[model samples]
Target chain A: MNPPEISAEILIVDDEEQIRRLLRGTLTAAGYRVREAGDGQSGLDEVAAKPPAAVILDLGLPDAPGLEVLQRLREWSEVPVMILSVRAQEQDKIALLDAGANDYLTKPFGGGELLARLRVLLRRPPGPVETGVVQFGTVTVDMSRRVVTKDGRDVLLTAREYALLRLLVAHRNRVITHRQILRELWGPKSEEQTHYVRVYMSRLREKLEDQPHQPRFLVTETGSGYRLDVG
Target chain B: MENTERLRHPGWGYLTALVAVSAATGIGYLIRPWSDYWAVAVIYLFAIVLLGLRLRQGPILFAATLCALTWDFLFFPPLYTFVVTRVEDWMMLGLFFVIALVTGRLTGRIRAQEQAERARAQRATALYELTRVLASAQSADEVLRNAAGQGAALFGARLAVLTAESEQPGRLVLHPSAALALTLVEQQTAWEFFSGRARSSRFAPPAAAGGRAYFTLAVAGRVLGVMVVQPAPGAGLSPAQQELLDAFSTQIALALEHERLRAEHEAARVQAASDRLHRTLLDSVSHELKTPLAVIAAATESLGATVAPADRPLVQEIHVAAERLRGVVVNLLDTTRLESGGLHAQLDWCDVSDLVNAALKIVGDAQLGRTIHLRLPAGLPLVRCDFDLIQQAVANLVHNACRHTPAGVEITVAAGTDEAAGRLWLAVADDGSGLREEQRARLFERFFRGDPGRAGGLGLGLSIARGFAEAHGGTLVAENQPGGGARFVLSLPLQHHEQVPAE
Candidate 1:
């Protein structure tokens, strides 16, 4: 089936006027209609009156309880909901998912990250479908033919290197938790082997970026997970 | 002849009696001529012996009178005649009779009075010693034992005191004695007495199985227990003994009450010490945790601004983790402050919606992409509260919901006024798995966690939140929603007048 176009109405719920204005401006710039709620209760009422395509929710409110707002919204609507919280515990993520949330984002996230997560939620693919050509900084990858060229010159990449690069490129501009990367590469039971992802990611950065120490494309989320900085 | 000398001694009582009888016989002979007075003299000797045994004073006086009469009748007249012809003889008889009567009466009265005074002195001394012993006894058990021993020694009966057990009902510990055997029913009675009930039993009398005693020890009109003493063989307690027992019982009651109060005071002192220590430890640990977390957060925030775009994610993670750690520290500090009377909320009249907005902003910036819903009315009245503190509490609830639930899950916050109850109700609900029965029981207790696996907290968020609510004359409660997830409700008294500053 063809994925829906990126035309959903996004509601920004935040107490800080600056943060709400920032979110409204960012979402509008990304070609989506935006509304704002200053607190949790107003955020819920806005969504209930006319269900939005998606909600960007803040976990703290003054007039009404934050968690209560989340729970009440889940009672009747399944409109994709994303949580905005400062806490980064694994249990928090798990609980939000169990409470009918679709995604989670920690604080201080940039506009790119916000947009990337939105795209993934709105356009979920049924299964892995390979696209033959890939492009980044002056580099083109042809997965079908197993060839790579930088600035139109043939560049050699080992078979292992290509596989690792393809995985990073596929989940570009979004965070891929260490567990997810490990499971995808070495099976579910070996997800705890984070060193393997680190070793391969280092090798990929050396081959692709001008500066491996501070690569523009590959980013580490430190204790939380890893993200691909594809801007 | 030696025996006759011994008999003539007037100081000896027997000799005095004999001399009086002989005199009476001589008088009778002398009076024989006057009248048949021999029988009267013999009767007088018999009366003297009987009176000496019964009316001790009366017998001697009677003997003296009879002697005088015999002299007048038999000796002062012609032989075998009842005639007193001489006036001198009459005066001599009268004088002799008066002397004899006066001597017998004075000696008998003096002896009787001396015996009575000695008995009174013995009783007084015993009473004084008992009072001294009771006053010095330190513990209830000591008082009981001493009382029993004194009762036994004074009354000549075996004594025992049964005291209430520390941890058992209808049970008592019999003080070290073999005087009385206690039955279950009697123990039950004693237990009732200790529990402020009056009970008495004749069936289980003192020092005898099934022989109840006369005196019951009581306090505040309630019997404490019984003081049991067996009656000495073939001897019941005298009036004096009974009075002594009653006095001992009163002392025992007073001593027991004093000991109980002292023990209670000691227990209270120990409890206060423990509470103070616990609070001190909490305060110190929280302070220690706060410093490091603040340092880390500051360091990370500065690093994020300077670091290259590629390294920003790592810096962000550090900042996030530090902030979370700071949240835990703040919770601990709040708890300690409440315990130590150090927390002071700055109260003000603030629009509830504005406070909600501030909390939502902080949570939103932190959450980034997560969804949360709110249902607040536009014209909600201003509430008197500590704005920053309430905001922090709300943030904690929202952050907790986000962490525990799955991504993109919705959380809701709602507020309304209950006019009938004259209160404001704010609720936070989540769609995640609800709290368990055990978790609900201890949800607000410090350092209690529902999920052990979850990391980065001291488990003080909910506890601190509840504490803040209570300080503002409100209550916070948690319950599981029927469909799924959990809901937390915070209710505060609606402000009718101008807000007052926090004291």
Candidate 2:
């Protein structure tokens, strides 16, 4: 994966001129090249003409909805996309994420939060990475060996808990919906049984986190889902 | 008056009968020398037949008797004496009498049948006119007006309509142009019919009291109203007229129901359009206000990087102020939604641990150096609720604790379930001073600020938290914990808990 020092090109597709300018200013200051599109059509055209390292697409656009643009882009490109949406649009955010967007930031987000989220998205590229080993907080999981160690000691985890941890580590720092987790961990028939995930998560937290209630890495997204915050 | 004319004066008919018999006698006397008594008898029968054409049964029969007597006295039997000389003459007299009686009876029956046919046609026309009038009426009010007017005309009576008030159910709306002033008892009777106690009533109030007939205006078992008709003094509705009135009421009820449905449909259409407009306006307003706030916060962050350390605090102030303004805008929108009855809970299954963590995330470490404890019990059953709404409520409580208490205070967030009561409870407790006696009573009032000097919100967080709780058929209450601090407990009903398979 390319680092920010490489000056990766970032495209911003938003209807508001001021928002685009702010985004451009923030990214350019953070050592990234920036491009702009005022509507969805131009955005799609720009992406087609020359794909950027990352795209920041606003949900609302004068020409077309951001979801359509994302779907159209996902048809051929695997470039990581970050969506900009309003606070009241949690459902739309989930839909965009499920539709191949890598991350989303609610509107009125501070520059620091935006950059932090973008950095994570960029660090974890679109295709699966060869993450043989991963570490967060005081815990380390060697994926290829199927072994998890906390503070230089082997920690006991049930088979389901180990699988859950693997899924979270696979997409570290990204929020996964309950539906997504259920489909992957159990069969799709158990999607409505969210308690399975909750019960298993509590056990994993007890085994790995110093204080299971105040988890450092494994985080809850309330109504949406769970996110493993490795930062 | 018209019905009286149809049954012409029997007195004048009797007088005409006498003149007809005398005319026959005069003609008989002139032809006596050249004619037999039978000839005189034939002339008498001719007069009786002519009188029968214009007279009813009683008058025509009188004419028959007179003509028969005149023939027997003047022409039959030993002239001018009441004696029967021959059996053939007596037989002739008897045959003539029988013929006269038969002619009178037949003519009377034909006239009566003609009158009955005319009456039927009149009723049919009246009913048809009423139907046309009611069908053309455009509104419920108009329908009632036309119905009453036509009904009054048809029955030769005054009519009053009492309808059920739609906006205020159970209240009655009496038609404005009602000519019949119903007495108290009559009104009660009308109400009884409207309420489905009676189908119809023939309320003939005694004496000079305004007697009336009441009919319930119903369609498909739903009573729309009641109709009261005050018949002309001393002229009550016959059974035939009552049946016609029944038909009249049925047509009126149908028209009223149609009009009501049309009005409801139009209102719903307008309301839907207005609701759509309201949602759009709110979204745009939020977007417009939030965009600039975002810019300000982001700009402040980037600006602080270049500013000297001494000036960084000023930039940070702007950032903090912008964030506060954003909160205010959100609160305003939320309150507006609540007041407008638009905040419907989109319920879903949720874990209490997730809810608590999300609230902490939203609070964002604003509680400088506070020691926050989590007491979420193991194996807490999942509860069904609107996840976002409950999260907001929990966040508001935590935020309220952070804002009201001094820095470094310990705030505990705990969750538990009351299985016996079928409820799930979440509490945010702070080791700050408990609420004052006066503040406890009005804490959840929309804009009631307990500590005016406190640098915090627009006094909306607690109120909004309560509203969200109620939306989930739950309750939020604030009381002093027994250990000398304030606690806000949000209890939500857990009715639909499912069986969790062992994992």
Candidate 3:
């Protein structure tokens, strides 16, 4: 049971040489093994021959649509995928994320942004409800005890706040839709209870964040939903 | 007048001529002392001329011969005798017969020629009227109705124009408003007419309506359609009338061709406009996208080897530019979809603070120097809306406020609900210099740059923002703030959702 576990490897499926080079250098320096495929067909073949721990697919592949490649890959494997897309296609990003890609990094992203997303995707445990301890900024959450600490001082949360925080921490760095949050905290029929999420989230951030107005850990994903940032 | 009426009947023509001559001879005898016997011969000649004018060739010839015989019998130079002994009297009798034959034939031919000319003139007038009506017709149905009416008047027939339908082969449809109907004979004629087996056909007796003639409508050997013509009651077509039917069928064929070409032209126009729209949409996006890509490339590429704590703003610059570019691109796509009528909102329960916060995330870093304040009541009810579209719209407003205002100005985004109005209000207020006095009207138009001095946008942000707002059954308006800067307010019909039952 104590035998050494091999570190995860990443596969980059993109047509742009600059994008691939940028990703490869950064990911290699971050201590993850990297592989590359230039077009969709070869990418699929590489994925088929030996599945990587994760895939970073560019939406505008030379051989086929990146979504098509993603759909095909989804048929064979459950490897986490992070999509690369130009900012021009917000609709496409939403569709790809909803289509089961783990996350997306819009084009013209810096090395820091790319690495942070990769860390979120690669480092998070596979199970959606894993419970232990997670730290973000100056705040620390103990999931088993259902407690949060800011600067080593205990922070108070109501029953609803604790539930929301626990759920967001379980899926930290990945966006959770408002509907999902409402449903999880308020039960199945509570998807329409968006204000509940908003109020509790603000209260939780106020207690946890150094400044409640400009949150450094709990972040809003604009049109998508919310994400917990571990900086 | 009685004699002329009699002359119209075959047997009665010559009988009437003989009777008139005999009556004149009797009168001549009664006035023997006063009237000359030669006067009786003159009366006989007048009777022959009347018959020639009224009767056809054969009857007029019979009348001419009968009158000459009656003159010899009743008042020859040997009065009341069949024989003429003198050469002078014999020559007189021979000369009278010759004059009668020539005069009769000449008068009959003149009448026939006059009737033919009158018929031809009427056909020309009908054709002129048909062309005039068809020229002003705007659509296929209008053309058919006018043609049917004009054709019925011109040809003395009830007419229907049947268009060959490609979808239902072997079946044709009459123009809906056409007042004409086809019998079995005309229908069969149309079937054969389409195959080029028949050109002009007449019905045996009509199965139902008064339809009689069927003429194939074609142009340059391409059979376009068919025309069913029913001769008017008591006015069955003559040979001349049939010729007119053929001519008018050609006119209908021309109109049908015009209708086909017009439909094709309409389809092509629609296709071309969409293509132009697509090109403009891409142009709006790409032209704006290039600058940000160049900035990002420049910023991120220099991140290596130029590493220093002071250079940290470089990463922030890339992040800001990337976000700014995303907003522009999103607006372009939305504008395209809106223009094409393809963008539809997927409405769901939404929160006002969520919209404000989301917009801040998008435009916050780019305009970091400016302060953005979000104000919302603690318990604003959920308004059903498409969250993404509303976010884009709000981002555009905030981004516009950022672009128009100089650094260090405060921008406020606030929301509230009006219960009585069943509406929700979201407004973005800026403290920078408000809208110019003259720029108010055209500000919401696409590609409208408020001031020439301001730079780096396609001017699509406001128009797209308004487009999103309107799509959710809402209205977006722009106005100058009382003190300074512009105020853009979006009002939506509120659909509030109830609180979820907790487990």
Candidate 4:
């Protein structure tokens, strides 16, 4: 069978030349076409001139506010935008998210983790669709019945574990923020409690993956969110 | 008329007795042709004593001379009453009148001088009592009340004290004695006195409110207020009574001045204490930030050095140390900002989980050996707060737990919502040596050290934590856990209206 062709483009916006260079090199080597902007206004202009499939935005911009840029882009575009910032404050993250950034990542992120998040963001399907019996490896998720089977046999899951698994399955092939998972499984106010999500996600991975260390379905986005590999 | 009626009657029945003795002597002379000269002398002495007792010196002398002449004419070889035939008899009568007049004048002068001295003594005693009463008063109100009451009693006049209000237009408070509630007019006159305006009245008729007597109370050219005293009905105060009132007013002024001084002193003492507390807070916070900053600087400098790849964990250690140091500095800055009136929160709706994780990152990095356990329940409400400040406060609590607990001890971060109270509580608990009862009392006090020998810290961690919590309309408390550890809890109001589901 022929390998799938890669076609999505990503824009890297940061003031630091080294960070921009590192991101460009990493993304390019991972089979992605990348463009760069030194400041916020230029990044906005670049997006306006030639819209990319995704954007990697730094919150500390030299010319304009990063949030403003995010807001401006959100006014007309639905392309996924990830905020990069040294400010790891919860309020800052909430503000960026509220301002229309899709996800947030703090500094000192690893290259592999960045690529994994980009891959998931780029692979999001157009809209919600009804699909029965979602399969990954030997584990099959029967969405309608709220059941899971591994090695063609039924698997037992607690009420909480089932809820968590269903949430990840619903947002499959896209980056589901930690806050989003918590809220969906629990409630809106439980978004700050990432620990709950972490515990249940561990349980789900242990049950379904052949080796949980190298998860095929549930993957951490590290500092941003989690993504379920449905492709 | 009363004085005249009292003088109308003869002051003594003894004067009549003397006149009878004179008449009897004349009769005896006539009956016995020659009365003894000794008998005549006794008659003259009796007349002199009678005059001296009844009238003053002049009258006594006249009566004494008349009796001597009568004796010479009737009993000393003169057959008729009026004829003084013997030269010796004439000389004796003249000496008697002179001696009688001199003794009467001396007696009258002595009696008048003694009465004057007694009046002076009475006035002095009244003045002394007035001074004593004014000195013992406590507040300005008390002083005014006492002054008015005492003045009225002492001088038998109605008294009112008016004191000035500190505010604009400088109004007066009229404190009237119970003896007489001042009329509205009298109060207005007192106000006039307060304004240093002169007014007078005869019995202080309402229209002419300034009564016969009113004076402004002044100290060093500044009028404190006024005092008004009206004499008794049907009679004005005597000159002496008025003079005494004036003297007492001066004493009142002096006493009021003393009270003012005392009040000023008390105000200054309170201001000094406030200033001292502010300065101590500043010094404590600055000192606390220094150590953390030094650690951050040292670790950051070391990371730039050439080290073996195998020793990269050392670099990670340095990075962790620096992050911990940064957390400490952030707490100190937060506390200082809160105390110095620089804490302005950019309040927003936040997920408590996000808040908890941010705090955990800072605090978890700082824990060198202890393991921190976080237990956050699902479905807690969003809290409206300054996220940075709340995170720092939590970080400070965690850092405190880490520092106090033994190596490998468990430190737990727990959060929950109190639905009834509409508040959220985040607690950090440590399984280590808990605080003693005494330490718990002052745990949140700035620069208070629980264990002085444990580490070199400025001891501002808990204080800052509490300050930040309180700044957000919350409370922070530290107590020993029932299971033998210390627990620090921060309680904050949950944002009910702005609750947003996490997405």
lDDT for model 3, please: 0.73
C-alpha positional error of residue B284 in candidate 1 after TM-score superposition, expressed in Å: 2.7
Q: Least accurate stretch of 10 residues (summed lDDT) in model 1 chain A?
A: A123-132
Top-down lDDT ranking = 2, 3, 4, 1
Q: Which portions of model 2 show Cα errors greater than 4 Å?
A: A1-9, A29-32, A48-54, A63-81, A91-103, A115-231, B5-128, B131-139, B166-173, B199-210, B266-270, B302-312, B418-422, B497-503
lDDT of 2 by residue, B1-503 (tens): 44665456558888998998899999999998898878888888788778777776677777777876777777766667778767887777677667666777787687778766766887798789988888888787887788778876776777788889867675577888688777677777677767767653423232244457777788898878888877766576766677777788888889988988898899999888877887888888888898899889889988999999999999989988897888788788888878877778876677787788878877774665788899998767777887778888998899889888888789999999898988899999998888988999999999888898866789998999999999999999999988888999999998564654555
* TM-score of each model, paired residue for residue: 0.45, 0.80, 0.56, 0.46
Give DockQ per model, in order: 0.01, 0.48, 0.13, 0.03
CAPRI-style grade of the A/B interface in model 1 = incorrect
**Clashes by residue pair, model 2:** none
TM-score quality measure for candidate 4: 0.46
Judge candidate 2 at residue B391 and give its lDDT.
85
Error of 2 at A61 (Å): 2.8
**lDDT tens digits, residue span B359-432, model 1:** 67557655545677777764465576776677777777776677667777678888889878888878888887
Which candidate number maximizes lDDT?
A: 2
**CA lDDT, every model vs. true structure:** 0.65, 0.81, 0.73, 0.69
What residue runs in model 1 are displaced by over 4 Å at the alpha carbon? A1-231, B1-124, B135-138, B162-178, B183-224, B229-231, B299-312, B327-399, B413-427, B433-483, B488-503
Pairs that clash in candidate 4: A188-B501, A192-B353, A192-B354, A193-B353, B200-B210, B201-B210, B201-B211
